[model samples]
Target: MTDDAVPDLRASDADRERVAEILRDALAEGRLDMAEFEERLDATYQARTYGELAPITRDLPAGNGVAVPPVSLHKEPAPTEGWAGRIVGGEGSSTGAVAVMSGFQRKGRWTVPRKFTCFAFWGGGEIDLREADFADREVEINCIAIMGGMEVIVPPGVEVVVRGVGIMGGFDHREEGVPGDPGAPRVVVTGFAFWGGVGVERKETWAQRQRLKEERQRLKEERRREKLEREAGRRELDGSRHDLLGDLHGRHDPHRERRRGDTA
Candidate 1:
């Protein structure tokens, strides 16, 4: 049977559970409010067929509540074009950085390999990928921070998955679970931390910020020009009306004079 036909069939507990997961993702992504989520969750459990379940999340970003395909562990990285062009499989420009008592940084125009490792002991390190190319579609950044800190900054549209553990320290995964753009590389962050922290943050590059600023300025100028044009049109319309009324009055004045003369 075709995939669409499956929806007509009865939905099992696993199907409901899958829909629930999608709902959870939607909620986390701020797609649904608490009231809508509770309503949908109740409907999901009571759903008997895929058809009934599909409409609950049909308008969501997850696409009709269908389960997401699991990320394959053994799948080979495939070469692609467009945004994926940034993912050129090869050796990384730099493999790793170590800071014992100071700091290290990897930023700008570098190549991130399939696996890049870093260590920090009583120091800090920064890995910025705003202007970097990926050596593979899937790359892992292994961080080991001991009584120190490490920060990984990525540009918008890149997928980030954080699976690191912290003991008496923390892994800042505020950017985790956010969906990435199509054809963008996926970043997997994993490692350990002891008495230190590793942070993963997503930010717009300088160029991107500049572009947004220019776009806003352009839009503002356009709106201003439009308002000016509308005001000019209104003034022209009022002037025309005034001229037409004056001409009518002038024509009637001669007739009024003739009428008065006849009366005299």
Candidate 2:
């Protein structure tokens, strides 16, 4: 979307926090008085749309910069994670996870089903899909947290929708409306949170990062070895040239035959 389209878009908690940070900076710098800061802080939390948040810090520098963001909201660039390749159609490796006064984790190289469910009671669970294959392009993850918490982690490029109810708790919708890659999977998070929270985050996989690191190291080592070999080859060529020049000038002399013929 264009810059003009941003104002009408729904604002995430991150947007609100950005504005709040600017207001706090203004207060610390004496640009705003205590009363003004208090009023603006309250309004910042109540803001729901980008348009509503635009005016809060209209006169102040954003994130303590002359050139700031969200003061002029821009559409974030989407990353390509080769979502089409990850969408392997078949049965999921596993379906669900449960935690009762304990914790559970669903991560690593697994397949996510179309409708996977999880529950937590006085406990917590983690559903990490960074390295997961998908049973379908669109999948649903249902979570039920009671007096506990559940965290769902998805890689970037995936679209997320949170339709869960939270009473005295919350379901994180920060990653919503961020847009997905063309062939990326759409994950719908639904269910109930009673005195608990379900948090959704977009993060790069540790496995991917580690693999990249190792590849870089391998390339570096390969280059170093090639450089050493080239230097050694050059030294050997120089030594052979020196030996040939010494033989021509010293030990194997053609002048000795000429001298013998003159004597005869």
Candidate 3:
């Protein structure tokens, strides 16, 4: 005789539709994960009375149910002070000028280097752009790196877009060459980053232009072996004849031994 004085049973509509069928059987046995089943189905539609719907109807599932807890997502690295633009859903957003390098700590694993310059346009989550570095001029990154590694230095035309897979065990956008001035300002790296390592040098293709033409033919054969050992010490200080067949057989064998002893 202590259940709220056990004397007032006035719930209608078939007992509020049997407590909304036990919160839809605790959201179909999964026990709710769709954002807590939409916040307990919007608090059971803004419950007005009945002690505010009796603790979401006694946390439902008194019988057949129980199971739901698996939501892991981690890919951090987006915060600057001077000029980091457009990092959606998570935070940090700038428009025009920026140049920041905020404070982040991590010594055990070693982390601290976001000296400003990040620009992400559209992403659902998960992004770690390998400490992010986009020299800055204009940018638009997408999806974000689930593991990390993203670097973009825009200036030419200033347009870049990486769609997926920026997972980095190492490298991304690490650029250096591209400044011989061909009417600069025109760069655009697009999508599907399913891995890492992409250094853009005028839109490299043909196997990265045959591996940069075999690394510029091995640096022009090491500058032609240092210009033939500095031209063999400037051709031994101009004695000039460095055995070109012993100076052409020492002047043609003394004119062929005086014409073979005057034709004998």
Of 2 and 3, the candidate ranking higher by TM-score: 2
Q: Write the per-residue lDDT of candidate 1 for residues 177-262, one digit (tens) a residue.
A: 76665577999999999999999988777875564456446645755786799899999999999999998998889788898899
Question: Residues 1-264, candidate 3, lDDT per residue (tens digit)?
Answer: 334522122223233334555655555566765456546544544332334455665655645342111111232112122124322222223212211222211112111122223322321122233223333333333322222234443322123333333443333444433231211122334443333332332232244345435644654575578679879878885555656667788778977879888998
What would you estimate as the lDDT of candidate 3? 0.37
Compose the digit string of candidate 2's lDDT tens values, residues 40-89.
76666655566767788888877545322344445542223467789998
**Cα lDDT of all candidates, in order?**
0.79, 0.80, 0.37
RMSD of each: 12.1, 16.8, 31.9
TM-score of each prediction: 0.56, 0.51, 0.18
Please state the error at residue 120 of candidate 1 in Å.
Answer: 4.0
Compared with the true structure, the alpha-carbon lDDT of candidate 2 equals: 0.80
TM-score (C-alpha, index-matched) for candidate 2: 0.51
Candidate 3 or 1, higher lDDT:
1
Scanning candidate 3 in windows of ten residues, the lowest lDDT window is 103-112
How high is the lDDT of residue 34 in model 3?
A: 46
Q: Write out the backbone clash pairs for model 2.
A: none
